[model samples]
Target: MAPPLDTRSPSGPAVSTLGRSVRQAGIEDIPAVARITQEGPLRTDLDPESAARSTRLLLTHIAFERGALWVEDGVDGRIARAVAVVPGGQHSPWETVGRVVAPDLARVPPGPDADQAFRTELAAVAPRWVLSEISQGSRARPGPPTLLEAALSWARAEPGWRHGPIAVVADTDAERKAAESLGFAERWTGGPPSPWWLGVDTDPVAPGQA
Candidate 1:
C-alpha cells in the first residue's frame, strides 16, 4: 500500500490563468500532491510498485516553508500539474539528478537512501533552490507554461535563493527544452556515473544568448 496524505493550506493567492490556478502546496495537500507525482508515467523500465514506492519515499520529507511544491488546479477541481522545487544551498542536486530519478530508489524499503540523497544535495548546492520534480497529471500533454512561470517566479522572489543560482536537472528532451527556453544554462552532461544533464539559471536570460 502507499503512504497516506497530509493536510495543508494555500500559501498565497492563486497564480491563475483562465480557470487554472497555481499555488504553493502545504502539508495538507499531500493527497493531491502524491496524485500529481505518483501518477506520472515513468520513462525508465520499472514496475508499478517500485515507482509508487519511489514517489512515497521522496515525499516523506517535504519542506513546506521553502515553497517545495506547487500545484496547478484545473477548472473542474482536479489537479492539473505539480512541481517539486526544493532548497539547495552550496551543492547542486543536478550532479546526481540521473541516479536520483531512477524508480529503483524505492527498493531500499527503509527509504532512507532516497531521503539522504535529497538532504545531502540540498546542503551541497550553490543555489538556494533545486527544481526537483515537475509533473502534469492525467491532463493534456502540453500544459500551460504560465503555471511553471508562476512557480519559478515565486522561487526567484525568495531572498536567499536569489543570492546564488537556481539549478535543475532536466532528464528528458522536453524537460531540457523547457529549462533552456526558460533561461537555464547547461552546465554539463555525464553518464559514467549516471546520464545527467545539469543546468543552472543564475538569473533569467534570453534563450539565444548565454
Candidate 2:
C-alpha cells in the first residue's frame, strides 16, 4: 500500500505569491514528473519511470513521517516542475531530509571518490550550511519565481525539518542571476567553467537557524 498523505500545516519559513500545492503522487504522476525533469526546458535526462519508481520505494520506507511530492503548476494547473521532500533518516541523508531535491552525480566533485570529494568541497564552500546541489533536468523547468516559491512553500510546511542548505550548479550568468534571486550566493567556481556552487543558506535571515 502507498503511504498516507500529509495534511498538516506548512512548516519552516513562509513566502508569498507563488501558488504552492501538495499532493501524494500516485503511480500515474511518475511519467509526467519524469518528463518534466528530463524532457522539459531544463533538460534533465533522468528517466521518468525510474524516478517515479524510486520515489514510490522511498515513500514506502519513510511511510510514517511527513512527506509529499511538491508541484508547481502553471496558470492552467499543468505541472511546471516537481520535487519530492522526504524525512531525514538513514536512507535520506541527514543533511537533505527536508530538501526540495538532492545532489546528483552531475554535481559530484572531481576526484577518485566523487561522493566524498563532493561533500568535502561542499563543506569548504559553506562550512555553516549543509549543501544540496540542483542541476538541470527535464523537471527543473519553471522560472526563478516558481522555483523559489515552491522551495519556500515546502520549507514553511515543515518548520522543524532539518536539511542541508540548498545549492545550485549553474553554468551561465543568467542561471547565476536566477539562483541569486532565490537567495543563493556565489561560493566557488568549478572546473571548465561549468559547475559554479551557489550557496543556499537555509537561514537567509537569522544566523544559526539552519
Candidate 3:
C-alpha cells in the first residue's frame, strides 16, 4: 500500500504543510463513502437514480483500481471530506460514469457540460494525476488548501512528478472557484449548448500554476 499523504515536496523544497490523519479505507468504508458522496455537491437536477449510479461507478472504480480514497475525520466524529485520487494515465471515475451519460444536459438543470469537460480534458491527459469524487460531509469545511495539499501529496510521490501535469474535476461552482484560486486553468469555455465543464489544469513545474 502507498504511504499516507503528507506535506512533502517532490524535489528539494520541503513542504511544511501540516499533515492530517489519513487511513487507508477498507471494504467497510465503502458505504460511508457512498453515502457522503450521495449527499455531495452534485448537480441539483440530478435524479436519485442517476446519483446512485454515479456513486456506484465511482466507488467501484476506486476500489478496483487500487486508487487512493482519503476520508477525513470530522470534529463531530463523522466523515469530514472524501476524495478519490487516481493516476493521470488511469481512467477516472468521472470518465467511466460519463460514458453512460453526459453531465450538463443529462438532467436539464445542470446539463452535460461537466461530462464534456471530462471527456475532452481529463480523458486526453498525458499520464499525469487526477483528483475526483471530492465531497465534504456536514462537518466544517476543511478549506480548499488542505484538499489541494492532499492532491499535491499524491503527485509528490508519483514517479513522473517532475514532468507531469495535474487535473481536477469540480462538480460545482464553489469547487471550481477554489481550483481557480489555486492557479488551476479552466479547460473549456464556449457559447450556448456546449455546457460549462469546469475542468482545471496545473503546470508541471509550478504545479499550482495554470
Candidate 4:
C-alpha cells in the first residue's frame, strides 16, 4: 500500500494570483464538486441515483484521501472547478468502486457506511498498481490547464513519482479538439459517445508512471 499523501506542499496549494485559489478538497466540498461534474461531459448512462451515488463515492474517496481531489475556488467562495489525479496502488480507495456500473455502485449505502463498505470491498482485491490520470470538472467553468498544473505539481512531488501520459474522455467535438490541442490521441471509444484519449510521454518511467 502507498503511504498517505502530504497535501500541504511548501508552496501551498498553488493558489493563482487571480482571485481563484486551487486547493485540496475536503469532505465538505463534495456536494459542490459533484455539481460541478454535472456541468461537464460526465457519463449519464446509468440511472440518476446510481450516477449520483457513484460520483459522491468518488469525491468522498478522493477528498478523504487528502491529496487527490483539487478544487479551484472562485472569488465568490464557491467551487468553480474540481480535478482529481488518482495515483494507482493497492491502497487507493478509487479501486473499490471506480468504473463500476449501476447496481454495484448503487448497492452501497450512503454516508459513513459507504466508506466502510468501500474499504471492505478494497480489502478483498489483491494489491496492484497501475497508471491513472488527471481528471477535471466542468470545461464550461474553467479549462484544465491551471488545475492540471497544480495536480501535476502535487503528483511530481510524491515519492518515486515520474512524468507520464495522461488519459481523458471526450464526449463532444469541443472536448475532442481540446484534448487534441493538449497532445492527446484517441485511444478508444466508450459509453455515451465518449472517446478515450491518451497523451503519450516519451520519457515515462519503466513499467508505468504510477
Instruction: Return model 4's CA RMSD, one decimal.
Output: 9.2
> Residue 81 error for model 4, in Å?
1.3
| lDDT of candidate 1 over 1-210, digit per residue (tens) | 112333444455777788888887656665566555445444455666665555544554533443466777879977765666665542344333322332222222213454454444444446665664445322334344665566567677665544667777544455556677677777754333233456678465323333
C-alpha RMSD in Å of predicted model 1 compared with the true structure: 7.7
Q: If both were scored by TM-score, which would come out higher, candidate 1 or candidate 4?
A: 1
Per residue, candidate 4 scores C-alpha lDDT tens digits across 1-210 of 123444433224457637788876666666676665444344346466666676777655543353366677788987765555554443544343244111122332234544444344334332221122223412453344555445545555665554334333333344455545444455543332222322322233333444
- Residue pairs in clash, model 3: 103-111, 103-112, 104-110, 104-111, 104-112, 104-113, 105-111, 105-112
Model 2 residue runs over 4 Å out of place are 1-3, 6-31, 38-52, 55-68, 83-115, 123-144, 161-175, 192-198, 206-210
Candidate topping lDDT = 1
Worst 10 residues of 3 by lDDT: 8-17
Q: Which stretches of candidate 1 lie over 4 Å from their true place?
A: 1-9, 40-57, 90-125, 136-143, 190-196, 202-210
Model 3 regions more than 4 Å off: 1-27, 40-57, 90-94, 97-114, 136-144, 189-210
TM, every model = 0.62, 0.50, 0.60, 0.53
The CA-based lDDT of model 1 is what?
0.54
Cα lDDT of model 3 by residue, 1-210, tens digit: 243223321112222223444443444555666666555355666676777766656564543244555555555545555555565554453554332222322333333664455456556655355664445422333254555555546555656555556666555456556667666787754345443344555545443443
Say which prediction, candidate 1 or candidate 2, comes out ahead on TM-score: 1
**lDDT of candidate 2 at residue 7, scale 0 to 100:** 44
Q: Which scores higher on lDDT, 2 or 4?
A: 4
Worst 10 residues of 4 by lDDT: 100-109
Candidate 2 lands at a TM-score of 0.50
lDDT of each: 0.54, 0.42, 0.50, 0.45
- Top candidate on TM-score is 1
